[model samples]
Target: MFVLPDDDDRQFAVTLARGLEMLRCFLPGERMLANRDFVERTGLSKATVSRLAYTLTELGYLRHDVEARKYRLGGGVLSMGYPLLAGMRIRQIARPFMRELALQIRGAVSLGMRDGMNMVYIESCSADKRSDTRPDVGAVHPVLRLAMGRAWLAGVGPEEREVALNQLRVGVPDQWQRYRPQLDQAMRDFAELGACFSHGDMQKNIYGIAVPLSAPVDSETLVFNCAVMDHTPQARALLDDVAPRLIAMIANVESAAGLRQTVTTTPPRYPRR
Candidate 1:
């Protein structure tokens, strides 16, 4: 294998991301792991795993059982993540509905919420006929790439949406600018249309349509979206059909959550492009 002499500098970040991926390898089930056992499952070199394990332990994100030489997620992980998870309990309520939508549309469905300047996918369900593009459950996608981001942006207050936009601009690579104007226009259009759709933003040949979940009483600022890369001759028609259904779904979710069950069926505040 040809290795660059300066690869060590680049290696540190890759190692950190790898270690995080290792943590995810252990899902909600199979909660514990032994050193020897972990190495085999993660496919990471034993030495690297050892060092990474020690680092995680120190950070309180992972803990080891001294006697069994086994490891488990540290309480620290929960400690750091509890409140966010608590707030996103909407996932528990929205999952079934999202599943229903996916079944109805024969597309991938997702329920999302805003976190800082990004749209976080709390739940996603892929239809049987459409497979291969697997989006990790907790993964976050840039707002400019998909309808989820734009839809949520439309619903949030200006302060929040602007801050999120600034953050996104900084986080994304500079090379992605060819689509910058288009994204800005989408955001503006979403504000007017009360929803958003996209083609080839995050991935080539992929398409998405999204709408802000109607906050029950308060009008939630987050979005609900559906994406498909499977196969479609008329992506636009499918997206349009999905929008009204998405609005009603959000209304159901907000009412169930008791956070905002009185949102007005107000028309989109922005002008059509």
Candidate 2:
């Protein structure tokens, strides 16, 4: 579930919010869920979950499996996203660049935008066709720990970043404590190195470098990330080899998108081998 608006807000639609939150209970791997599962995941009463599930099923947002007595997301949910993705022109412009970088690094490149307190990948490219863990277009990741998220925070205005930080602090206190220092370092890196680096902070064997676009697209700040997954993580190689290329790739993307002439950043020179 995501952060709810203040209870006192007069125009907030409680039932609608609850219904949407129910949909969010479906994770990537878990496809089907019973009313009891919704109750446990959403903290809504069984009766409320039942009503919402039935309503959503009627609306075509969910499909009820009579035999399995479970619910799964329906075509309506996917249809809802098509317009949003289609409207994001930046994704089209960035895909070629992202694919090139992914192939060069033999890793994954993704473009994402903030969704509530998390970041959702709008586009992803991976060189490894057979890798099970390749980032997918709809995958969501926390904003506090990942390089893509940190770069976003680094690029945004201070007031916006502060508001997001306050939300994270209240919503996930443990994560705030564990990743705050790393986020601070990432901010410095963004200032000095033109990108933010995640040295296996997101996942045990994954390293990433990310940079935010110089300008927002359709008033939405977007971030691009390049991730390398390996059993033997190499932080220096990410900084010295991957970071420069990722920065340049973002610069080229920004230029192509006409967001700016080009990104102006003091990217570190690639280390001579």
Candidate 3:
């Protein structure tokens, strides 16, 4: 279910929010969904789901499957993201460095920004053979599950970090036990090294290391990550060596983008447990 402000909240548009919530029901690898799926996911009445689906289809935000009776996201969704992606100065400034890092590690490098409870990839550069789980622009992953997200959480202030972590715990209670220990360790690692690494935690055979980057031009916190598909010794060595390089690359990008003076120190003030 999606969260919505109370009716008393100012400037809240219920219909528009519900429409967007319906769109979010289509997750990664989910190509199509029927009206019933929306009803079930959103806990809305069948009539309401049908109406929302029809409205979205008419607006071109969703494409109706005439033969299969399903709906898929349409070009309209891309329209919403294009402006943001095109306007991101950090993506432009970091692209060349991301490409170089990918080529140097012969893997994938991505820049992502936090989106609600997930991290959304805004820019990605990949070597010839990319990891199976290597996400492209617009791909979303759980915030606490990926190295990029963990690094970002590490950079946030304590209160914000606690809020995000609490959201994760409440949203995915089943996985909290397994995630807590690793998250604690990542906090320590980031405190010491300014970066953190993950080995097949989010996806088996996918290894990654990430560092956070905060640019002066944008309020959003972004992270840079280098990833490899294999979990072999070679991949581990590459991850270990590339992490520091990734940090340096971010430093260079921040310097070029005039963000060095704005970057915050590590182990950002956290509330005592």
For lDDT, the strongest prediction is: 2
Model 1, which residues run further than 4 Å from truth? 1-56, 62-83, 115-118, 173-176, 216-221, 233-236, 259-273
TM-score, model 3 to reference: 0.88
> For residues 208-251, what per-residue lDDT tens digits would candidate 3 score against the true structure?
78888754247787889888877544776565567767777787
For all predicted structures, in order, the TM-scores are 0.62, 0.89, 0.88
For model 3, the local distance difference test gives 0.81
Worst 10 residues of 1 by lDDT: 264-273
RMSD of each: 9.0, 3.0, 4.6
Instruction: List, residue by residue over 120-163, the lDDT tens digit for candidate 2.
Output: 99999887877533677888888987899999999999999889
lDDT of each: 0.67, 0.84, 0.81
Which candidate achieves the best TM-score against the true structure? 2
Q: List where candidate 3 sits over 4 angstroms from the true fold.
A: 6-8, 129-133, 214-217, 230-233, 261-273
What lDDT score is found at residue 94 in candidate 2? 90
> Which residue pairs overlap in candidate 2's backbone?
none
The candidate 2 region of ten consecutive residues with least summed lDDT is 264-273
- Candidate 2 TM-score, true structure as reference: 0.89
Tens-digit lDDT track of model 1 for 1-273: 111234467545667665775675564457688766657766777898899899999999898889877889988876776676566667788888778777766677886666543567767877764454336566676666667877777767779767776766665546237567767777766756666878777777667778876552224466778776635656555665666666666766777778575643432233323
